[model samples]
Target: MKKIFISILILLSLAIASIVPFFKSVVIEDGKTGKSLAFFDAKQGSEFSIEYIHSIHKTPVREIYQVHNEEILQTEMRFQEFGVGMPSGADEGEVFAQKGENYILSNMKRTFPSLDIRIGQIIANHTLLLKGHEYPFSGLSEKGSWVSIKVDNLNIWQRLIGGKKLG
Candidate 1:
């Protein structure tokens, strides 16, 4: 009986170790641009999915909103310099970026003409909010993510970085 129980316990431990990382993996499809960001290989009962997209230099500023249950979740806002800029469309209340309020902020537009697109990752955090309420969020990282703006209708780093595409 003792031998059987130990074998079963080892099997159980191995099963659990293999399963946890799969749930934590956040995958973004169409990751080249910001069109369709999603979590891949996600568990069925996952409460939230995380997304990360990196576009730099001359990326058009469009509306940013979350789609959930066939309904729009929040208002779209301008993303510049690693922070939320002026919001577009009607007021839909605050978002995770607005709520976090104290994140280190910077813009690649000032010195460089464009920014660099780097590997993105997402993790679960309780501080994320949708509309002033704590909720699951796909928080963009400051150190890894990058962006740039236009100057005189031309990008400063045209040769170094290409135009940022929006979806």
Candidate 2:
């Protein structure tokens, strides 16, 4: 009876441990605007989308990015310039848009020189929500034009075990 009880406890603990990481959340911010673009509940291989807007030649431009595994896999840009002052050669009924893969990282790096964003690493700072609780992160990284805050996978075990008390 004692051995059976111990085995059951071990299995239960393992089950809980495995389930904990999925509840973690990620928060992404646009440093230039000082606004949060997305709050995502993410796992190691999960995907999510973020949107940004800019202006060019008095035209409003919007871009949506698809992020997966800490990498931006696709992007779509749309230019909003519908009115009497539209460019002379522009297509009146057509939307100006462009999309491709592996473009965001380089663009972001060039645009936000202070942030120094990389392709594979997650950015620090901003709020991380895990299992309905909020934990503000403060780590080393220059605030630039964009930033992403995600639960550190390397510290998942610590987060899962210590999160309850911290939260």
Candidate 3:
């Protein structure tokens, strides 16, 4: 009986070891562009932040928000709506760029053009309000460059083994 129990325990250990990698989170980063892709499991009601780096100055910009209903709203609207001043619908990129400049001038009291505004534009373009528990998020830059974010769901083996923590 003792030998049989030990064999069973070893088999269980091996099974768990083989399944742990599937539950682990995956992250990819771009060395030249400072872009990244991250995939992880997040419980409902948890909050997370996405960080963007300035291409020219190498400054870090962080956008923090809660994950409500498994969605993260983008900082700016991607397209212009047909309303009020925009009867013909304007490009969101141009509109947001101007807004960024105006916001810096009004709030930061800066006269010269700041890269921070461009950073905001990038965040707005790439960062999307994520939806669904097992959905992927792709963050884009002002130049329309993007990175992938994929969340994994635990499989039966992982669930039976109590699952692993996502990184």
Candidate 4:
């Protein structure tokens, strides 16, 4: 009886260990429908970014983020020129600099549980950067729709039925 109990405990531990990897994912879901548009496997400290062209300035801007504490933390930003909604200088606990033509803001501590973004109908050219690959927003969802980006732990069934991976 003792040996049988030990074997059962060991098997249970192995089952849990195998399911953990399926839990960590970066989920891009439709805000209105609550359907996952795309999901990709990621570790706890992985980083991803979104790059888009400023609609008015027509310059480029990139926002870098890191997965931490089961949330997405906006860590840095690179942009060209100052315009509406553009940061002129670093606020408290932030570092600002300029590298060539682009201005960079680093060491930012903004945290968001999820981000709701509206894809542009014609412009903005939103792109997701992960693992040195680029995924255009247009390909993830339709134009002018809202998407919520968040880090979610999906169960095995959810992960199996989830949307296409970013890769």
Q: Which has the greatest TM-score? A: 4
lDDT of 4 by residue, 73-164 (tens): 99999999899989999989999999999999999989999988888777698889988999988898998889999999887766777787
Taking all chains together, each candidate's TM-score versus the true structure is 0.24, 0.33, 0.30, 0.86
Return the top candidate by lDDT: 4
Q: Across residues 36-60, which tens digit of lDDT does each residue of candidate 3 receive?
A: 3334455544444444443444443
lDDT of 2 by residue, 1-167 (tens): 99999999999989787656444444444445434443444554443322222222343433333334544432333444443433223233323333442122212211111221221123322333334554443322233334543332323444444322232
1 against 4, candidate with superior lDDT: 4
| lDDT: worst 10-residue window of model 4 | 15-24
Candidate 1 — which residues are off by over 4 angstroms?
20-25, 30-59, 62-76, 79-167
- Each prediction's Cα RMSD? 16.9, 11.6, 13.0, 3.4
Off by over 4 Å in 2: 1-8, 11-26, 29-38, 42-58, 81-146, 149-167
TM-score of 1: 0.24
- Over the stretch 65-134, how does candidate 1's per-residue lDDT look in tens digits? 3333222232333433352343332323333343343222122111222123343333213122223333
* Residue 39 C-alpha lDDT in model 2: 47
- The whole-model C-alpha lDDT of candidate 4 against the native structure comes to 0.88
- lDDT, candidate 2, equals 0.37
Candidate 2 TM-score, C-alpha based: 0.33
What lDDT score is found at residue 61 in candidate 3? 37
